[model samples]
Target chain A: MLLKLLIFPGFLFLFLCALFFDWVDRRMLARFQGRVGPPWYQPVADLIKLLAKEDILPTGVNPLTAAVLPMVSLAAVLTAGLYIPFGAFSTASFEGDLIVVLFLLSIPALAYFLAGWISTGVYSVLGGSRALLQYFSYEVPFLMALAGPAILAGSWSITHIVDYQSQTIWIALMQPLGFVLAIIGLIGKLKRDPLDIPKAKSEVVAGSLTEFSGRKLALWHLTMNMQTVVGIFLLVNLFMGQSSVFGPIPAFLSFGLKSVGILLLLSTASALYARLRIDQLATLGWRVLAPLALVQILVATWIGG
Target chain B: MASPLRSLAYLLPQLWRALKEGPHTVKYPFDPVELPAGYRGRVIIRAENCRGCSMCVRDCPAFALELEREGRDAYRLIYHPERCAYCGQCELSCNFDAISLSNEFVPGKPDRKDLGVVLVNKEG
Candidate 1:
């Protein structure tokens, strides 16, 4: 009970903060396109409404799966946040290797895949398969891209990575290839547009979420939104780690501002590009992105290592 | 192979031109490209030309027009932006040329209740 108490608030805080980031993302994208976006409170309002809405289950959906799937996704994402070193504070830390973070980060998609499959809906089955493939395609490039940063700081631990960045030039400068690839990979993992094949609205109806509605649907949607925030947070920590001095207002605003910039970049891409198909996405990852990322690793290792 | 090589040689300038040219991506958030003129967007209505005729009311694909008639003859119009598909059908059907599809896309809602676009009679 006590441990649950400890975990709950942290997860809640992360979820709420993630939603704020999503709102900022929409706002920036709106500004980018010369349109006024939803207000910052929009995400909160949306979640509230979605939670209050009727939960609709498709025929043959396992009630247990429906109830547990979203919670698991949310739990996994928040758990990673516990481990992730944001600026300086990591709720849990060990030797600072992102190996743990990488595995933990995979939880969201894994949960999404399981949810998609267990729903026993055709749309979800297709979505689940696509999702599995999608994660498979991007994880390699993401790992390779991250390897450059690890090489620079001589550590896989993100705190050390951040600390190392402050000491030297930001690793982004030394390993531009790695930085760019990582950003691309970040976009991929977030399942944002141009790589949003799994959740492709045009192809799969809500992709993995076609059968979900009401509170359960709300939780699932909420998890994805939070994952977006986490994705942006990870990117910020890696490339633009903590630019503000410590204080509630200033630290909050600065962190918020850094995240908004990332969100803006993400949303802009989302607005401009159409999503690639599953096979094309895979090909892009393995054939194109992998080679390009490999070049970065080669260069970073040769030069920095 | 020779034919392909010839084709490559012939296409060398094009390849060189592409290499010399810049990236295709718009430098967004900095250099926002212009939205096309006919881009489907929010609908705005000119109250002056908007006669009391209920043609647009019936013709709107979203059934977006709700005429709130006042003072027996005087009237008010409510346009639901959320429901309005921006299909340009309303603009096309409006004989008085009252409605236009503007590029301004409003996405936020202060309240779900604030759904209607109110057209109050400001005319003297």
Candidate 2:
């Protein structure tokens, strides 16, 4: 169990998968924009380059806080990975692990908030506040959307949800509205296009990341990418029935293919859409997605009951 | 609200077209770049036709050219690529058809001196 948590299907596997997914996102975005993207090893190269750079801490900022937040964010995401079922294996799961995963997933964003807050820069403060606001707006719909699957599966355990899907149809088909809501909520959570206000480069100058450099910056980037992997992993396990229809090898292959498909879907959406303002993002999350998610939960509960 | 949905409908077809068209970027460096007609890149000096005239040196906006006398009637033209703006003024000012611009734009050198091009009049 320790080996599974630390190595395969856990930290190492998720880390590598996160890097690959980021590459795919960048490559697809570049192709969409009529440009050649970086090579496949670009993410690894970037990480190495960042590590080699001199760590620069801004004045009037707590050096310890700045140094520790990135690791905290990364650890939070890696710990979240432990509960996620990849293909036929889950590293560590228990009753109500979904709640644990949900809580763990938010830690990185909170770390981002704290990092921004501690930076003592105007842009960082603005970005930190925006990040906190965006979190509040999206969390409600995101949780409500998850409730659809949990209600239908009758268990909060991720493994139980997957097993339920194997015995029945995938929850995505049953809760199409919930699936759409979840995707929208995820786009906001991931800070992708049409909802990428917090780190809007033109406005906030890299948002909360303005003060970060060197190894901290690299770890922050790694954490963001890992969040993408964890998000898609959760999406697949909860909505798309994972690995039940085939043998272990095929199940693994199918899981990979599904995750890639989700990544591509996100990339395509990001390429096609423009960034939204904070007000617009809030409205979409609160007025639109939240209500839709509530309706989905109600319908899912009615059907399940 | 409906507009976002409408844009999404418009985006799907556009995304499909982009995927079908493949990547629009050229594999530069590995594959040869397709330069347009009359593309002015680096300046080239024709030493045989050059009469050591200072018109090109004077007209160079970037002051990238220098005239040196190797001996009496033996003139050598020196070009500093680092200082060159590649504005084609030197190519246009030369009356002897001595200097022209080539389409080779990729400038690479191991040393600073390597960027300097020197041409000597062999007949002198």
Candidate 3:
């Protein structure tokens, strides 16, 4: 049980997948911008370099909280990974695990908010506040979007959603608006381009992470990468239908291909759009995305009922 | 503000073209850089052609050139490339074509003193 949890579908697998996906995302984004991207091993090399660097703590902040926030965020994302059904394989799938996974997925954002709020820097506080504010804007739509899939499948479990889609059609096909909303929400949640207001280098100079360095910073990066993998996997299982398209093809390979397609779409969107202002994002979310998500839910409910 | 659909229509083709054409950036270090014509780089001096008139030294804005006159048309041209601006003023000021900027880029060196080069004219 320990071996299964720790190796195949757990930390090691998630870690590698996170690095690989990061590379793919970066490469695609670079290609879209007409620039050569980093080599495949750049992510791993960066993690190693960060881990090996010296850890510096600014004076006047609580050392324990500073140290613990990143770990907490990382742990939360990793735990969320276990509940997700990767290619129909899950170590801890249970009733209402969807809610649990969503809840678990949100811990990092809170931790990020605290990470900025607790720090004494001007940029950190500003970034922290932005992260918290943006959370409300995207999270509502994100939740509603995921809820569309759940309502249609009639189960709050990821495995059941995948199973339901395998029998019928992809949730994406049933309600593409929800899929679009979910993808946008995922970008906001991950703080990628167009929604990366909190960490805009020019505006905030690494934003909430301005003070972080060495091991803590490395952990934060790993947590973000891991969260990306988990988020994409969750979306794939929710909207991409079955793990196997036809007989003789393994489930994981199909899942991987679908995930790659999603990643490409994400990278394309990221490259195409400029970052929206805080006010613009809030307006778009409440006025546009949230309403559309609500409509998607109604449509899903009507279809399911 | 352009509508989202219009923006998408404009950007999608650009992104597609960029992806198909690959990166426009030159892979430096991995590939050699192609220098354009009349590219100013390191300075080279011909001591035998020098008139000891100190025109190059006087014209050098960076004060990188020092011509020590030994005799009529005999000189020691000392060039401090570390301080050179590569403005080509010295090259233009040389009446006898004693000095010119070559197209060879200067590589970085640890020691500051190694950046200087000297050309001695014994025959006057």
Best by DockQ: 3
- Model 2: residues with Cα > 4 Å off, grouped in runs: A243-245, B1-5, B34-37, B68-76, B110-116, B120-124
Mind giving the per-residue lDDT tens digits that candidate 3 earns over B17-120? 99899899988899988787699999987766876778889989999988777777566778898899999998899899988998878888888866668854
Kindly list the per-residue Cα lDDT of model 3 for residues A83-199, writing each as its tens digit.
997785778888899999999999999999999998889999999999999999999999999999999989998889988998888889888999999999999999988899999
TM-score of chain A of each: 0.90, 0.98, 0.98
- Measured with C-alpha atoms, the lDDT of residue A275 in candidate 2 is 87
- Return whichever of 1 and 2 wins on lDDT: 2
List per-prediction Cα lDDT, in the order shown: 0.75, 0.86, 0.90
RMSD of each: 11.1, 2.6, 1.8
Q: Candidate 1 at residue A241, lDDT? A: 58
Local distance difference test, candidate 3:
0.90
After the best TM-score superposition of candidate 1, give how far the Cα of residue B35 lies from its true spot, in angstroms.
25
Q: Give native contacts recovered, as a fraction, per prediction.
A: 0.00, 0.53, 0.83
Ranking by TM-score: 3, 2, 1
Pairs clashing in candidate 2?
Answer: none
Which parts of model 3 have CA positions greater than 4 angstroms off? A243-249, B1-4, B69-74, B121-124
The lDDT ranking, best first, is 3, 2, 1
